[model samples]
Structures are given as structure tokens and as C-alpha cells.
Target: MMGWDQLAAFVVVVAALIVVPGPSVLFVVSRGVALGRRAAVSTAVGNEAGMLVQVLLVAVGLGGIVERSALVFSVLKFAGALYLVHLGVHAWRHRKELAVTPEQERTTRSSAQILREGFIVGVSNPKGFLIFTAVLPQFVSPDSGSVPVQLLALGLICVIIALISDAAWGVLAGTVRGWLGHSPRRLSFIGGASGAVMVGLGVKLAFSSRP
Candidate 1:
């Protein structure tokens, strides 16, 4: 097993990694700004759950095996891209409905829907697989005892840090969103911009070649 110093170093690195805004974090912020902080936190929790799944899959050699196969890589990539485009379209199509109103605030997305969406994104995200496939293995050593256990420990720490950081962002976004509620026109602009970004990301993902 890695020493205390080594584990602490890994935690620091993990924290730094989470600070970089990824799709998951962006989703939470947008949801928070558009919906509420509660929704954003729920989404982040779902995202963290998805991330835990990725960590576990990688730990057991499953992620490596799938990544090693060119066919599997292509399939996963395309599938992820399709999902992204689907989400982008969904957001764009439902822009009006998602636009917050006093009454709309009374009801929010279901828990099942939140978790389902979160799990789907985590499982389907090729970039996530790529990150763990490359990053996790780098810190692991056969001499350090069970690689899987180390991975799980590292993964949990990563997820915890991300959840906290993202929740913080969600709170901040939610505050801004609350203040802007009266300005529907400005809110609309923000929503449109976020939608466009999602679509652009989907397009980029769709066209990316296997590494």
C-alpha cells in the first residue's frame, strides 16, 4: 500500500483535477441557475455517483480492457456523443418549460429522473473512461499491494472533493439566478448561451476520433 505521504499527494492532485470545470460541473451550475440550488446539488450528487461507478469499473480492470479494444472504444465514443447531442436537443427544445416561473418552482424534477440522468452520463462518458484509464494507472503500482483498493480510495476522495466544490458553485449560481429571476429577458439570453455551448460540445464529441 502507498504510504501516508503518497496518499496525501494523490488527494491534493485529485482536488486540483476537480477544480477544472468539466461537463458535469457545468451542468450543475446551469441547472442551479435555471432551476434552484437544490436541483443543482441533486445533480451533483448524481454526477458523483456516476463518477464513483467509473472509478470502480477502472479499478477492476474492466475499464482498461474495454479501452484496449478499438471496437469498444469507437462504440462507447459514438454512444456518448449521441447522448450528448440528445441532451443538447432536449435542453433546446424544452427551453421554455425549463425557464423558471413562480409556479414552476413549486415542482421540480423527480429524484429518479435526476439520478437516472446522472448515471447515464457517467456510464456513457468516454472522456471519463479515458481519464481514469490514463490517470489512475499512473499512480498505481503492483508493489503497492491491491491496485483496485488504491483506486477505490483515490476515487472516493476525488468524488468527495468534486461534490463539495460543485455544490459551492451551485450555491453561487443559484444566488445569481434568484436575483435575475425578475429579468426574464436576461435569463433567456443566459439559457440560450448555455444551450448553444452544450450543442457545440455534442458536435465536437460526435466528430472526435479514437485516440
Candidate 2:
């Protein structure tokens, strides 16, 4: 088992990592901002579950080669970027037609759908595997006793922080959306802006240098 001080330090580092605006965090926030807190949580949970698989694979060292392989990273990056672009384009196309009434938006999102969406967003991201493979091992010590346990602990910390942040975005978006229900045009613009941001991020990510 890891020492108390080590665990505490690990928690701090993991928490900071979670707070950073990475793909998972951004995906959850975007969902929350566009959907609702419940949907966000569903997405967060799914995303966490997706990440768990990556962490476990890394714990067993299955992902080490994948992480180091530029080809693998490039493939995943392009796929993820395309996914984001698709999502953005979809949002933009429908932005004008849908009325964002609370009742309507709330009714539209099933928990299952939210979870599935979150899972897809997290799984499709190539960066999470890289983080698990490259970044996670730096914190582990032979003295930690069980590397798997440590990895699990770190993954949980990340999930908790992501859930909190994403949930906040959902609540805020839902609230603002309700208040601004009268101006559908304004809401349409918001959707367009969000779509543009997603597309831009996708393009940037596709071209980003691997560490």
C-alpha cells in the first residue's frame, strides 16, 4: 500500500490533472452546457468508465507501446478530431430548429443516451490512453505495493473532479437556457458558437505535437 503522505500527494496531483482542460473535461463540460446536470453526470460516468479501461490496460503495460507509437497516436487523434467535428457540425445543423425549453431538452435526453454519448466521447479520445501510459506511471513507486491499486485510485480521483466540473457546467447551462428561452435566436447563436469551438479544438488537436 502507498504511504499516507504519498497518497495525499498523489491525490493533489491527480486533482490538478483533472482540473486541467483536457479532452474528457471539455467533453463533459460541453455536454453539461448543452444538455443538463443529469445528462452531464451520465456522460461523466461513461467517460470515467472508458478511462478505467485505458488505465487498467496501462497498469498491465498493454498500452505502453501504443502510447509510444506515433502512428497509433496519429490514428486516434485524427479519429477523435473527426468525431468532434462531426458533433459540431451536427449541432450547428440543428441549432436553429430545436427549441431549448427546459421541458423539451430535459425530455430529450435519456440517461442511457447521455451515458452512451459520454462513453463515446471518452473512448474515442486518444489522449487518455497516452496520459494513462505516460503520465500515470511517473507517480507510481515500487513502494506503493500494488501498482493496479494506485492506478485505480488515481483514475477515481480524476473521475470525481471531472464529474464535479461537468455537473457544474450542466447546471449553469440548463439554468441559463431556461432563463433565455424567450430568445431562440440567442440560443441558436450559442449553439453555433459552441459548435465552432468544438470544431476548432478538433482541428488543433489533430495537428498537435505528441509529447
Candidate 3:
């Protein structure tokens, strides 16, 4: 039962944050460049699914514990970073696979596997969790029907905006992939470069201090 004014403001804030091409967007773009539009879209969907779960936890009050506990935060942060690094290394090792036609490259990894990876990344991302913990409560009011319901509604709005933005980025990257599909060398280079980006993001995340 958040007020229209609060909801609108929340939407604006979420939209601004989501459109900035953060780690989540980069991950989807990487999937698009390495895999294809379908994989990218699937990854976006999966990432949102994981985000939704985080929102649920936030609504249930567990999110505060995570926000307060440095140990838990570090554990989640490192887990996500390591997973991204693992994925980047795997992609770099298979960089030549991008040389295949889009149709064939799409088959390189199953949609389920891609989705699962995206989900893991989304759920384990300490940044995402912290954002929720910090932002979601601000717009909430005691007069609202239920704090949990308000949080869920706000989180859903955030997720929808993010999914649309991430999907657009994925499609754009996929178009670039299509353009370079004709050249094996360029496709290989794209793969390596995208993988390197992921690795860099992971390293940055690993070294980032608690806020």
C-alpha cells in the first residue's frame, strides 16, 4: 500500500540504477556476445528470478542480518566473484566456439545451464543485496498495508526495469555478435574480450571494500 508518490519515486530511482550497465547488465551482455540473443534473454530472466528471491528474503527480515554481518557479506561477495571468474576462464578457454554460426553456438550451452549460472550470480551478488537492504526500506511506510508486501511491490518494480534494460543490452550485444559472426578471428577476439571483461569485473568486486 505504498503511496503513488513513493512508488513513482522508487521507480525513477530503480530505473536510473538499472540503466547504468552494472555487473548484471555486463553479465547478460557477455552471454549475448558469447552465446546469442536467446541465451542473453534467458540469462536476464534468470538473474531477475534470483533477484526476486533476494527481495523475498528482504521482506522476511533476513536481509537485515546479511547487511549487518560482514562475514556473511564477504562470503557472498567472494562466492559470486569466484563464480564469475570461473565462468570467464571457461569462456576464454572456449573462445574459438564463438566462430560457429549463431545457431550452432546457441547449442554450446543449454538454456537451463545459462539460466542457472545467471541465477547464481544474481543471488550471490552482495551489491544487489545491499541495494535492496538500503533502498527498499526508505520508501516503505508503517501506514502501508504490510511492510513485506510493500517491499515485494517495490522490488518487483525494480526487477522489471532491470530486466528490460538488461535484455536490451543483451540484444544489442547479440547484434554485434551477428555482425562479427562472419569472421572467425573477430568472433574469437570478441569472446576473449568479453571473457576478460567478466574477469575484470570479478576482480574488482573481490577487491571492493564494504560500504
Candidates 1 and 3 compared: the better one by lDDT is 3
Write the residue-wise lDDT of candidate 2 on 129-190 in tens digits: 76677667777777757887777677666556666765665667657655655787877776
Per-residue lDDT over 94-177 for candidate 1, one digit per residue giving the tens place of the 0 to 100 score:
666555675665565576776676666656667567777876777788897888897777777777887898788878887887
Q: Write the per-residue lDDT of candidate 3 for residues 1-211, one digit (tens) a residue.
A: 7667867888888788778876788999998987778888999998988888999999898999999999988999998899999989988999987787656755677889989999998888776787799988999888868888888888888888878998999998888888877888988888998889899889988999998
Winner on TM-score (2 vs 3): 3
Cα RMSDs of all predictions? 2.3, 2.3, 1.1
Question: What overall lDDT goes with each candidate model?
Answer: 0.73, 0.70, 0.86
Instruction: Judge candidate 3 at residue 90 and give its lDDT.
Output: 87
TM-score of each: 0.86, 0.86, 0.96
User: Candidate 3, clashing residue pairs?
Assistant: none
Give the runs in model 2 whose Cα sits over 4 Å from its true position. 106-109
RMSD of 1: 2.3
Ranking by TM-score: 3, 1, 2
Instruction: Count clashing residue pairs per candidate.
Output: 0, 0, 0
Off by over 4 Å in 1: 106-108, 209-211
For model 2, the local distance difference test gives 0.70
